[model samples]
Target: MPGSEHADRTEDGLSIPRHRVLVTGATGLLGRAVYKEFHNNKDWHALGTGHRRARPRFLRCDLLDEDAVKAVIRDFRPDVIVHCAAERRPHVVERNAEAAVDLNVKATATLAKEAAASKPGAFLIYISTDYVFDGRDPPYGEDDTPEPLNLYGKSKLDGEREALRHCPAVAILRVPVLYGEVEHVEESAVTALWDQVQEGAAGSCMLDHCQQRFPTEVRDVAVVCRALAERQRQDPSSVRGIFHYSAKEQMTKYEMAVAIAQAFHLPASHLMPLTEQPAGAGARRPLNAQLACCRLRQLGLDVQPRPFRTAITDCLWPFLPDKRWRQTVFF
Candidate 1:
């Protein structure tokens, strides 16, 4: 009964049984959000692991190191582990295929096996991507067989299988291009484009006009991860297997760039339209990678992903001047 306060429900009926939640890739976008959510929640014994970072309860452990993974498992014994790390950049993965496999595939398998061995029914939520599909299909569902066009997708699909094989019961949440605000300006793919638009001459950004993507909000994603982690603690049987969560809107990179330009009161005349993938892109891009979140909706989960336009405001608010925004009467 020493740490009983950490467990058990409070008088207000807010706190559930406290769970030891370990989030991997705590330094990354979604990982940071997830870790922050866990850290803020009083019901979670949150511990984050990443490389070369120091937060309140964060550990600096590289997932590629097997000894480090084992050491974390031995020391923490987390009841629920949310794995938000992966080799995401398609071109980067193409250049380093072996490293991709090691990070995306081997790291997941290691974590899953460790979780299974450490705690029975330990929930592992693997953050996957829409690249698992060939992009030829539209609105890919959970049942669709993976046909990855690039190394990143293939590595993620392989990682998915490995996690399924090792973890007791896991939620493989596949997301789309995420946009969020971070300590740095160009942290995510969307923000990278935003940063490009923010600082450049006319006609700087030329984005793909035809390729479609669901611009998922990282805050919405963090909310869902919190639900899954808490459900894993309260009712592990509720969520299992592969699921997709993305914005309802299907936007072109061209449209997204235009939106970003408009959101921050920047000129869009310079944003050129791209018909094909740019030269030296390294890997083939997913031209039609749209994801549907019907599963989460069907399950009646709270805090679904918001429209990309609304999420855009959340990302750009920090960059906008209060009086300038007030003068323009921008919502």
Candidate 2:
């Protein structure tokens, strides 16, 4: 019934059928990229849903509120729903377990249910994390058993289960550390390394060298999401189940810091790599949860990642105190 409405016209005033894409947590790092990707695509119309930071283009909706979520789905009737809203912070999830479950698990279930009940039954893409796998044995495949190290990972795993349970056609995408355009450097784990690099420049600073992370770019993940959405749109049963999408490049926090220092031409003599994990932490982190991109590659999707050195430098350029240095290094 939703598709019976008059089709929108393209630039040439030719009628073009468009897929309605709804992205949750549009204000967040990955959500922003996903929203932008769909918004820019000529084949689809994107509507981003956010809470605190909701803007003119984004719809303001608190995911925790079941009524609000149902209303959003019922009204929009999106053909594809990219669910990115969740309590992703490990320490924060540890601090507030109830809130994490409510947002991560309950909200996901509600969204999946609402999407499934929609007129055309929207294809859902649930954004998960590599933390679902305990860093014991990796790279983890699609069917690999998930053993979460912390509550954050467990919550995400639970969210994935909820999404799959309600919507069988859901695509669960698990990614590692993400970096991209950010309102602030502290927003992303990889970009936050610049702060550590700055700290190291002044005095002795230690970063985790033990844990290996495949830092994937948000824009790349957005592309993957778009591809998956297109695949699902073409054939509903084609894209389903768990999918791992991550960068091939591997680097520890210490290594990332070193790279940041080198890019900014800062002194790295004071930087030290901690070989062992710190004691008495709020939540335990995986040593290395390298996600295998076998499923994505097999699907003929572009799993290749941008070069870390060049990408990271470009991402951090705006934050550089001196703009003159960018003309020489970046330009």
- In terms of TM-score, which candidate is strongest? 2
> Which lDDT tens digits does candidate 1 get at residues 1-331?
1132266655897556467788998888888888888888877778888776645557888899998998898787777788988778888898888988999999999999998887444678999999999898787888888899888989999999999999877899998888886666567777667765655464466777878877888888888888877665566777888888887777787888788777666788778788877676578777887876767777766465677766776776676546766457464
Clashing pairs in 2: none
lDDT of 2 by residue, 3-108 (tens): 5235776689876547888999999999999999998886777889999999776899999889999988888788899999888989999999999999999999
C-alpha-based local distance difference test score of model 1 = 0.79
Lowest lDDT sum, 10 consecutive residues, model 1, at 1-10
**C-alpha lDDT (0 to 100) for residue 84 of candidate 2:** 91
- Candidate 1 Cα misplacement greater than 4 A, ranges: 1-17, 54-57, 199-201, 278-280, 320-331
Candidate 1 local Cα displacement, residue 297, angstroms: 2.1
